[model samples]
Each structure stands twice: as structure tokens, then as C-alpha cells.
Target: MVAYGFKRWFSPQIQDGTKTHTIRGHRRRHAHQGEELQLFEGMRSLHCRKIIPDPICVAVLPIVIISSDLIDCGIAYIEIDGLPLHRDEIEPFAVSDGFSPDRLRGIAPAALVASTARETMGRFWRSTQPGSRFEGVLIRWRS
Candidate 1:
């Protein structure tokens, strides 16, 4: 079985079936459709815990994430399977990936609820250095 680890914050969403997918940097081996996946949080640590019962891998798509200061958000947005996400689709996409601003810290309650998906995702991707591009896969599992 292919195992995937997520951050502690994501455990609730994953357990509730709200977060169904993950974006990861590319590796020589990746999960494929029809395979079972082991999802956990804090793997290899004393606090490690399983987030959800095993779920079947449903889809895997190529992904590219580009970060640039020129863009409003450090992220230039992302492309899945070679197609860029439309402006209107960014918020929902970010939300699905558990980017709900209210769940984040250091933001005023008012602004937390006000942050758009683009803004939230941009902030999330801020860890990537500007001008760098990340190539990876979008792995989805059936809920």
C-alpha cells in the first residue's frame, strides 16, 4: 500500500472526508488508480495517527506550481494536467484543499473570513521561493 502523511491540521478534514486530495512534489514512485492508500498524520513520530480508514486511489494528475512576485499571490496559480485553473475556480479549489482562511492563524477574524481562495492559496504557497517552479502530482482518493 502507498502511504501518505498530512499535517495535524488536516486530520479533521481528512477524517470528515472534506479533504480528498493532496498535492505532492514528484517522486519516482507514486500511487495509481485502484490502489489502496494509507493516510496518516505525523508519520514516524510518537504522535503519529491515522487520519482516515484506507481509501482507494481514484486519480493522479500531473501538477505544476509556480511562484512569482509578479503575481498577486506569490503563487502564479497552478496547472493540473497542463491546464491552468480559471480565476473563478481558484477559491473553490483552495477551499477543497483545506485553505479556509478562518482555520489559519495571525489574521483578524474579519479578514480571516474575508480572504479569498486566491489570497489564501497564495499565502499557503508562500513557502516556495519566488521565481521557482514546483512539479508534482495531485493525488485523489475516493471518500
Candidate 2:
């Protein structure tokens, strides 16, 4: 499966490019009857009403992503399937939209990767962690 994340530059005047990320990690499991494909839009899920499909083929599975197009909230968006659905689509069913952002909060597990920024990302998720269920943060509304 492949996923891409896009981030908007905080300052439009600057020439900073959006972050393009390829989804990594997470082994296939039988739980949810192999039907439990999930996505987190930063701290919030797109909404509960949104039903997602988990593909059986690994060579070409659906790419789930989380991203935000709204820049004012400074909220990082999470996109699953690269669909254009907004917060309104999932608000009715969303369970924890208000939860504190943990995307960059707890990275202690990445300590062994060294303290440098480049090494940190490399160590934390340059490659997917074994047994981990989710992918690392990709596109932040701003970061």
C-alpha cells in the first residue's frame, strides 16, 4: 500500500515545499476480519460515519492518509484514502476530536535514534517499527 501526505507552508511568501511522504509499516492482521482499515486525522478521526475499506492485496492496497487543508486552525490534517472529506463529514461520528495532539508529543521511543532532528526521524520511522499498528505523522497543516 502507498499513501502520500501534503503540508501547506505557513508563509505563502516563502518557497517551502509541501512534505511528500510514503506510508510505511504495519503488518497485515486478521483482526476486524482483516476489514479494520483505520485513519487518524492528526488528533481526530475524519468522523465515525465514514466507512473505509481494507484491501486484501498487499501489492496494491488502498493508501489511507490524514491531512488538513484549513490553515487557520494550524491543525494538521489526517487523510485516509486521500479522499477530500472535511471535518464536517466525520464530526457527527467522531469520538475524540478534542483529544490533545499526540502526534509529536511522545517520541521517547525514538531516543535511541540520537538527539539530532534528521537522525531522530530516521531512527523513529525511517523504517517501520515491528508490531506497530499505525504509521508516523506525515503532513502537518504546519510544521
The TM-score values for the models, in the order shown, are 0.84, 0.22
Q: For candidate 1, lDDT tens digit of each residue in 1-143?
A: 89999867667778878889999887778899999999999999999988888999999999887766576654566799999998677777877887677554433234323356566666556644344687889999996
Query: All models: lDDT?
Result: 0.76, 0.28
- Per-residue lDDT tens digits for candidate 2, residues 1-143, read 22221111111211222221224434443122222233222223343221123222222223333323233222233345555347554332111221112222343343423433223333333243443234433211211
TM-score of 2: 0.22
* Poorly placed runs, candidate 1 (over 4 Å): 105-114, 128-131
In model 1, the clashing pairs are none
Off by over 4 Å in 2: 1-25, 28-30, 34-63, 67-76, 96-143
**Candidate maximizing lDDT:** 1
The lDDT of model 1 is 0.76
Clashes of each: 0, 12
